[model samples]
Target: MEPGKLLENSELGLRILAGENGLNRKIRNEDVNRPGLALAGFYRNFAHDRLQVFGQGEFAYLLDCGGEVEGRIKDEFFSYEYPALVFTHGNQPPSCFIKKSNETDTPLLQTTLSTHDFILNFNRIITRALAPQTSIHGVLIEVFGLGVLLLGPSGIGKSETALELIERGHRLVADDMVHIRHMGKGELIGESDPMIEHHMELRGIGIVNIKDLFGVGAIRKKVQVDLVVFLEDWKEDKEYDRLGIDEQTMEILDVSIPSITLPLRPGRNIPILVETASMNHRSRRMGFHAARSLSERIHSRISQQITEDAERENPPKKERKKASPKPLMGPV
Candidate 1:
């Protein structure tokens, strides 16, 4: 990310201190550093390329150091090319910090948020900006509040299925080219190409704007991919997962998401099935897996039946028939 983009997007309450010339400087990586060792004259493995963060601890340490000592620290620290330095909690840096920033032509950024809060928020932006990403030809849509990516060979009716889903009140995130990125924490965020956002290409109908026809409610700028549905031509001999007990997953950008293969054929409602799959995916995430629940219930019933059958097969015998006869004789 560029310094200007960070300034525009960061929620850290950031304000520029000096180094207007460095606003165009690019952040080399998502890694952030506290400069604890760099402050103590340990330049080895200083990670000077990463963004430097100054909190209360570093600020207090700077205050205790003599002016010359602080200057040496800064010289050694800023000698390498860094993205920028951000001070948390609106802490004004010692004059030495500013002087060195101007001398090195490095961007100096400060934030009003506390050290912990700033780190929490900045980490998220960093993760997004530097996350691994890839582009795939598919349609991303929201089904039952779950994001589903439809992938298959060209002309497999992916766009048509997505259009059917949009008609059913589901929102479309992207069509044709989906830019998917792993936004840390195992999340894959998907968005459409800026060139074709909210647009789909039908076989003969040509390109149409989904938002134009369906309005903004049926459009989404981005969505997390929860499931992947690959539509394939119906193969009469290929077996399908009729029971849903066998779950499948596909990996994209090194992140795994649930997946299913739907065989396209005549007289089949692909959109409804996709919606059902999405609802089922949500249920599994909510700990209400239908397949597992059904299996357990069936197992319990079979166990109960076996126990009852055993009791019927071995009925209890009558005890002491002779004793009953004696009692009858005495009564007579």
Candidate 2:
């Protein structure tokens, strides 16, 4: 799913938040989970669905499933309760009502938005919602059993490179923002934010659609990462590896992922490099360490030459006295 499309799907929610036409209903559950916001009640009512709100001295909320609950209003009694309520639930009609409740001496303000409008605004709020005060942006790609994450300074062609990989018959696990969940045994699963899957923002181009461009097979919703690829600007003076001896690593959510630093220079085919890196990584995992093998071969040759040199310097002493001593002992 493209970010734009995700935004489009959530347009109703956005509109509802922006005071669009959606259902206005009260919270029916005694506990609503907005720990930071401190909103009360778990039950949210959708106006489109068959919902009946009964309020005389207290309030009772009824749902289509015959699930009815009686509870006292709490939290933001002045603000949220002041204006009826907006229901952002999907596939439900929008409805609202306001009348004199005994608890509040002031008359309640009953207002409602259309169900269609609530859905439009709901999506907007979800995509733009903050990440629990602890979140960062980056792209993660999984290839050849190697979870190589592409990281760099913003606009450094992270998404652009990923787009190329997808075109070259690779899968895209996540883009822009990845949600890394730690499943037990030191394993991490990388998933794209629901609202921004399969979307990349190109500098010259506004937003290129990945699935549409490369077909449905090019995009993936989630994947387990095996390596990280860090792209850097090419520097003339900086030294780079001519031999594949050094390995690198990167950390995400406290999990370490093998990293490779590749320079972005003109005429350099990065997509090919990335693919080769992934294949090399896979090769190493199958008990074939190229660097170690090379080192061992060099050491064995050096040891053999030292042995030959030591033999040349000190030849083996001849056993001249042994045969004569054995004959003399037999005669005695």
Clashing pairs in 1: none
* lDDT tens readout by residue for model 2, 1-332: 11122224433332222222222332232211211112234344422122122222122132321212112233233223322233333222212222222233222222233444443443334323422222346777766545667878897788888878877778877777777765535566677777777777788887777888888887777676788788889989998876667676676667777778899988988989999988988888787878878988999999999999999999999887654344535554
Per-residue error for 68 in candidate 2, Å, reads 28
Q: Count of backbone clashes for each model?
A: 0, 36
Best by TM-score: 1
Off by over 4 Å in 2: 1-135, 241-246, 321-332
Lowest summed-lDDT stretch of 10 residues in model 2?
30-39
Q: Residue 76 error for model 2, in Å?
A: 33
TM-score of each: 0.78, 0.56
User: What would you estimate as the lDDT of candidate 1?
Assistant: 0.88
What are the Cα lDDT values of the candidates? 0.88, 0.55
RMSD of 2: 11.4
